[model samples]
Target chain A: MALNLFEDKGCPLDRQRFTWKELVQPPISKLDDDAFTRVRVILMNGMEMEAIRFSHGCARMNRKWQLPLAQLRIVEQHQATMINGLLGADHSILETTIAYEQVAIEVTAAVAQNEPDEYLAQVYRFGMLEDFDHLYRYSAMLDRLEGKDANNILQCYTDIVPGRPTIVEHRAPQDNLREHYDRLRAAPITKLHALTIMSSEQQTQNFYLNVAPLYADPVVRQLYTEIASIEEQHVTQYESIIDPKETWLEKWLLHEANEVYNYYSCVQQETNPRIKAIWERCLDYELGHLQVAMNMFKQYERRDPAEILPGDLPEPIKFESQREFVRRILNQEVDLRALGTQFVNKSQEGVESQQYRQHLNASGSPTDMVAAGYEWFAGTELARDGEITREKYTRGHKITH
Target chain B: MDKTTVLGKNRSGIDISPIDIKEMMALAKVTPASSSGDEQAIAQMRQEYIAGADVLGSVPLPSTLKGMASTAMEKLMGKSPEGFIDKLGCRLAFERTGVRLYDALITKCSAAPMGAHIPLDRLHEFRNEEFQHFKLVENVIRSIGADPTAQTPSADVDGVISLGLIQVLTDPRTSVAHCLEAMLTAELADNDGWRMLIMLAEKMGMEDMARDFQQALREEDEHLVSIRQWFKEMVIKDTVGT
Candidate 1:
C-alpha cells in the first residue's frame, strides 16, 4: 500500500526546529552494511532535491516576497549541515566513497533503461559507463589499501569494468550541453530523473573535491582529481537536460514532492530498524515542508497545488541493481559522446581531437595507478577477478583499460 | 548582460534578471495541461495507462480498441507510452520479488536447525546482494521516468511471486534446502526472463541494453548455479536415503 504524505500528521513549521543536540546526532555505524547504502542514498537524494531549490529562479518570489524565501534558504543551509554532519564522523571515507559509486552505477543504469526519451536514455548510458569505471577504479584501491575485496564492500552486485575512461571525461564545459526536456509536455518523472542525477553527480563532484586533498597517496589523490573533474562535466551534462523554463513555484513543488517520495521509499525498504525510523521522521518533516510549499503556491501563484502535483503522489522512487540493464547499454553505446544538443558517435565529425588523444594515451594503460600498487604488493596486479595480466588489457583498448 | 541587467537591476535586493523573467514567461506560455474535475476518470485513466503499458506489444489484447487507443496515444504523446511503462514495470516487479524472496529465505534459513555446511552469513550475503539488485532496478525505473510502485502492471505480479515464497515462512518444516529448491525455480525464471529481455533489446537495436542484460545474466547465472548446488547438498543429500 502507498503511503500518503499529504494526509500524514506532520509537524508544523514552527514546531519543526531541532535543537543542536538533535541536529548533531551520532552517525550510523559503517559496520551496518545495509544502513551504509541507505544513508548515502538518502543524503545524495536530499542534496539533489536541494540543488533544484537553490537553482530555482522566481521573479514573483523575488519582487514582493524575498524575505520568506531568504529565511527558507537559511533553513536549507541548516538542514544541509545537519545532513553532512551525519557523515562528519571519522568513518572509513573509502567505503563511503564506494557506496556513492555503487549508487551512481546502479541508479544511472536504471535511468538509462527506463528513460522514455531515447536521447535522455543515451545521455544516461553515456554517464553510466564513466561511473561504472569509477567503481572499478575505487574497488582496486579498496583491495590495495585495506586488503579487502571490493566485492565485500560492493556486495558484488555492481560489476567492475571500464566505463568511458575518466582520463577522457575531461572536456571544455560548453561541450556538455544536451537538449532540454519540455517541462509542460514532458513527464514529471523525466524532470525528477534529470534533476536527481544532476544533484547526485554534483554531490559526487563535491565529495571528491574535498576528500581528494585529504588523502596523502599521490596516485589516489590524482585519481580523485581526475574523476572529480569528470563529475563536474557530469553535473553539467545532466543539469542541461532540465528545462530552465520551469517556474520557481513549479520547481519548488517538484523538489518537495521528490523529498517526500524518496523518504517514503526509504521508509518502506530500509531493513535496519534505526535507519528506518530516521526515514520515517524525515518523511514527516518533509511533508511539513511540502505543505508550506503548497500554501505558498496557492497564496502567491494563485493555483491549486493539485494542479502541479496530483491529489495523490505518483509513486516512490526505488534503488535497485541495474547490472544487466547497464551491461546492455555498455555493450551498445560505450562509444557515444554528447555534442551540443545531440549525442553523437565518438568518431563523428565535430568531436574534439584532443579528447581522442586522451583516450588513446589512456587506452592501453589501466585507468588507475592501483595496478602498479597491486603489482608491487602482490607480485601481480590484483583485481576482483584474481590477477590482472596482459591478457586483460591486451584484448582491446575499449572494454578494459 | 550582467546579472543586474537581466534581473531588472535587483529591486529590493532580490535578483530578478531579464533572462529569468524570459525563462519564466516561456514556461508560463507552455503551462502544463489543466486538470479536470473528474477524479474517478483520472484514476481510471492512470490504471489504464499502467495496464496498457505492462503488456504492451507482448500479449494479445482487444485488438481494434487497444490498437486504436495506442495509435491515438502515440499521436498525442509522440511515443508508445505503454511499451516503456510495461518494460519498467517488469523490471521493478522482478527486482522487488528478488528482494522479498531473499528476505523470506534469509529468515527461514536463520531459524531452521542444522548450520552444518550452509553458513547463515552466506545467506545474509546473498540477501544483501539481492537488496542491491532491487535498489539498482528501482533507480533505473525512476531514472527512466517511471515510478517503481507496485501498482504498475508488471509490478502487480510482485504479490504473486512473493506468495510463492511464503511457504518458507508459513511451514516450520521448511529448511534452507527446501528454500533453495523454491528459489531455484525463481532463479531459473529470472535467468530466462533476463535472457529474453536481452534478445528483445537486441532486436529493438538497443545494443547498450543487451550489454546491460548480459551483465545481469552473468550474475543471475551465478545465482542459479549456486542455488542448484546448495539444494543438492543441503536437501537432496538427506532426502534421497543416500
Candidate 2:
C-alpha cells in the first residue's frame, strides 16, 4: 500500500528505528568547522538588553501567541522539509528553490532603499543576515542527513544568482511589505503542525543531548539535535515576540479565523481544486484550532476577545474595493459617498410607494430596507441608460418607484 | 351515607338523639370546606396563582439591602466608585424610559382588540418590572448617599430608555440576552452583585432582608440555570434534527 501524505501513517521507509536514548549521543570525530562556528557565534553573541527589548516588542506584536502547541510543531516540520528539499535539489529545481529566497531578498532591498530610518536599514540587514544563516544551516543539515557530499549541496546553494531589481526604492514599498507580513501572519496554527515539529525536534534534541553514547560514525543524530535546538530557539524567538498578556487561546483564534477567511476567499475565486483543497484543509485545521481555543477559554472563564470587543469581531471580507464595485456597475469607480447619496435619494422615492409602505407596515425587516434601496438604485440606473420611458417610470412609481 | 359514620358517635348511658350525630357531622364537614372544588382542579388553580406569586416573594427585602450595599461598598473601595455609580444611573435611565415607552404604546393601542393587546400587556408587565427595578436600584443608591436621578440627567434619560425599548420591541430574546449580559457584566464588575447584596444586607444590620435577597439571588441563579439548560437542549435538538 502506498503512503498517503494527507492521512496518518508512519514514514514510507522504516529504514532505522532508533530509540530516543541512542539518538542523543555525541560523535567522536567532532571537527570544528569555521563557517558553522561563525554563524553559531553570531546567534549567541546578541546583547542581553537588545534581546530583551526585541523579545518584549515582538511578543507585544506577536500575533501567533495563542496558537496551539500542536499546530506550531507541524508548521516547523513543514518548514524544515521545505528548507531541506530546496538545499538538496539539483540545478533543475533551482528556479523553484529560490522563489522564497528571492522574495526575502527583494523585501530586504526595498526596505533598505526606501526607508528613511537608518536604524530600520540596519534592522533589515540583520534580518537578511539571519535568513542567510538559516539557508546555510539548512543546506548543511540536508547534506549530512542524505549522506551527500557538502560540496554538492554548496554548489546547489550558489548556482542560483541573487535576482536583481532587488532593492525596493519606491515610496509605497512599505505598504507592500506590510501586506506581505499580514498575509504571512494569517496562517492558522494547527495541532498537526505543532506535533510534527515537536516530534522532529524531539528526535533531533535526543540525538544531541546524549553526546557520549554514540561515538565513531558521523554523529548524524547529534547534528540533527543541534539543528533542532536552533529551530526551537527560533520558535522561542517568535514566541517571545508575542505578548505574554494574551493567552495562547486568543492568538490562535484570531489566526484561525483569518486563515478560514483567506481560504474561503481563495476557494471562491480560484478554479483549481488542488489549490482549493489546500485552502479547504487549512480551513478545517483553523476551525479545529478555534474549537480547541474555545475549550481553553471556557475553562478559564474568559470570553473570546472577538466576542466581547467591538473591533475584535470578524468583518465581512471583501475582495473588491470601492473602485471595483463602481467599475463593475458604472464602468468607473465613482466617489462612494456620492454614490451613497444617489442611493439614498432613490430609496426616499421608493419609500413613498404603496408597495414599500405596505412592506414596512407588515414587516419592519432590515432586509426590506436593503431590497427597497437596491430596487430604487436599479431603477435609477435603468432610467440613466434610457431603458425605461417616463410612462414606465410613472407605472413603477406606484409599486417600486 | 349515614351521618353517624361521618362523625364518630359519642357513647352515653342515655339514648343519644340522631339529630346530634347529624349536627356533629355537619360541623366536621365545615372545617375542611374553606374553598370547594375537585382536588385536581384546585391543584391546577394553585399552581397558576403561585407561578407569578414567586416573582413578588423572591424580591429582596430591606434585610437583604445590607449585603447588596456591602458589595457596592467593596466595589467603591477597590476601584472608581464613579464607574459603578454611572452604571447604576444607566440602569435607572433605561428603566424609566421602558416605563414611558410601555405607557405610550398602551395609550396608542387602547382601542385595539384584546388579541392585539397581548403584546402590549407583556410590554406593560415588563415596564412595571422596570419601574420596580428603577426604584430598587434608586433606593440602593440612595442608601449609599448617592442620587441615581442626579447622576443620569433627565434630558438624556428618555433617549437612553427609548434606545433600549426599540431594541426590546424589535427582538425580545436578543434584548433579554443583552440584559443578561449587562447583569453578568455588573456582577463581574462588582464581584458578583447577588453575593454582594447578601453581604451588604448583613453588614447594614438588615439580617432578614439580607436572607430574602439571598433567596432572590438563588432564584435568579435557578432561572439562569434553566435558561442555559433549555438553550443547550434546543441547540442539540436543532443539530440532531438538521
Candidate 3:
C-alpha cells in the first residue's frame, strides 16, 4: 500500500518525545540478528545525522526559522542516538567497519539500480564500485589483524571481493562532480536517492575520520585515511547531483519527504519485530516532520508541497542481496574512471587525477599493502587449516613496500 | 538458545551460503589484487614507521615533582631505575584491570542461562586476591617513592593488550567457556607480569619489593591453574555432554 503524504497527519513534532531509557534500548544481537537490520540502523543514523546537519545549516541561513529547526534538530539527535545505540558493544571497531562497508555496497547498489537519470545512475554505479572495493580492503584488514572473518558480519548477503580498486578511485576535485538533476523535472524518488546516498557517504567520511586516529597500527591508520579521502570525494560527487537552485524552504520540504519515504521503506522490510516498531514510530514521526515542513512551505514559499513531493510514496528501497547486480557492474565497469563530471574509460582518465593519485601512493598504498593477494575464505584466510604455501606463492606479487 | 554453543542459522560458515561462497571464491581467483606483493608489504611499511617511532611515553616523576622524582628515582634504584619503574607500573595497571575483569565475569556468570556449577565463592576469593595484589603493587610503587597512579609506557601497552580480554569478559553474548578462556588469558599474563616484576626487583637490589612480588606471583599462579582448569572443564562438558 502506498503512503499518502497529506492524509496521514502522523504524530506531531511536539508529541514525538523519548525518554533516556527509550532512547537507549537493548542492542541487536551481533551474532544472531540479520545483517540488514544493522544496515538499516546505520543508514537511518546517517539520515538523522543529516537532518541535524541540515537543520543547523538552515537555521544559520534563515534566522526567523531557527526555533522550528531547533525543535526538529533535537528530535533528530535523539532519533540518531536511539538508532545508532542498537549496534552492540560486542562489535569490535573493525567488525563494525565491515558492517559499514556492507551498508555502502548493498544500499548503494540498490540505489544505483533505482536511480532514474542515466548520468546520475552512472555516478552512483561509479561510486558504488569504489565502496565495493573498500569492503574488500576492510575485510582483508579484519581477517589479518583481528583474526576474524568479515562474512560473520556480512552474513554472505554481500560478497567480499574487490571491485573498482580503491587506489584508482581517487580523483581531482573538478573531475569528481556530476550533473545535478533538474528539481523541476526530476522524479521525486531521484531526489530522495541523491539525499540518501550523500548522507550515507558523508556519515562514512566522518566515521573514518573520527575512528582513524584510534587505531594503533600505522597501516590501519593509513588505510582509513586513504578511504576517508575517497569518501570525501564521494560526498562531493553525490551532493553535486542535488539541484542547487532549490530555495531553502523547498529543500527542507524535500528532506522531510525523503525521511518519510526512507522510514516507510524500513518499515516495509524490517524483519526484527522490535526494530520494525522503531521504524514504524520513526515513520510516523517523519510524516509529522513532513507536515511541519508542508506548513512552512505554504507560509514561506506560498507553494503546495505536492509541487515537490509525490501524492503516494515511491516503492520502498529493496533490502535484499544485490549480488547479481553488483557482479554485473563489477564485470562491466571496473575500469571506469571519473573525468570532469563524466565517467570515462581508464585510458581517458585525466592527467590531473592520475598525478594526484601517484603523489598520494608515493609512499605505498595502504589499501594495496593490506590486501596483497588477499582472498576471502569462509572462516578467514587463516582458516586454511594445514596448508602452507610460502615463498613460492608470494613470488611475483606486486607492491615491493 | 540456553546452550552456549548451538547448531542453528550460523551463516558465518560455508554450509548455509555454499553457493555464494563458491561464487565469491571464483571471483576472487579471477580478480587480480589491486596493488601488489604479499603481507611482507605491510611488514615493510610498518618497519619504516617502527624505525622512526617514539616510545609510548615516560613514567611520571615521583609525585610529578621534578626534584622529588629525581630523588625517588634514586631511592628506587641507583642503576637502571627506569626499567624497574616501568615494569612495576605495568604490574600495577594489570592487577587493577584484573579485578574489573573478574567483576565482569561474575556478572556474566550470574546472567548466563547455563550458569554451570561456577564456584562464585571461589570467584570472589580470586577477585579479592587480585584487589590485594593491586594494593600491594600500589604500596610497593609508593614505598619506592614513585607515583603508583602514573602510567608508564609498559602500563600503556598492557592497557592496549588487555582490551580484548575485557571486551570478551564484559560481553553478554560470550559463553561461560568463552569468558573462562578470556580469564585464562588475563591470569596467564598476570602471572608472568608478577614474575617479571620479581626478577626486575631482584636485579635492581630491591629485596623487599622482590619478596612482595614473589607473594603476588604465588597467588597469580593459583589463578592461572584454576581458570585454565575451569575453561577446559566447561568446553569438554559443552562438547561431550559429560
Worst 10 residues of 2 chain A by lDDT: A161-170
Residue A287 lDDT, candidate 2, scale 0-100: 42
How much of the true contact map at the interface does candidate 3 reproduce, as a fraction? 0.61
TM-score (chain B only), all candidates: 0.59, 0.37, 0.90
Which tens-of-lDDT digit does each residue in A7-106 have in candidate 3?
A: 9989999899999999989899887788899999999999999999999999999999999899888988999999999999888888989998899889
Ranking by DockQ: 3, 1, 2
Tens digits of per-residue lDDT for model 2, A132-188: 333333332233223222222121112111111011111111111210112123222
| Alpha-carbon shift of residue A236 in model 1 (angstroms) | 0.5
Q: What's the distance in Å from true for residue B14, model 2? A: 99
TM-score for candidate 3:
0.92
| Winning model by DockQ | 3
Residues forming the 10-long window of minimal summed lDDT in candidate 1 chain A: A372-381
Model 2 root mean square deviation, Cα atoms: 37.9
Which 10-residue window in model 2 chain B sums to the lowest lDDT?
A: B1-10
- Top candidate on TM-score is 3
The DockQ figures for the candidates are 0.01, 0.00, 0.59
TM-score of each model, paired residue for residue: 0.54, 0.22, 0.92
For model 2 the interface RMSD, in Å, equals 50.5
For candidate 3, what is the lDDT? 0.87
lDDT of each: 0.61, 0.33, 0.87
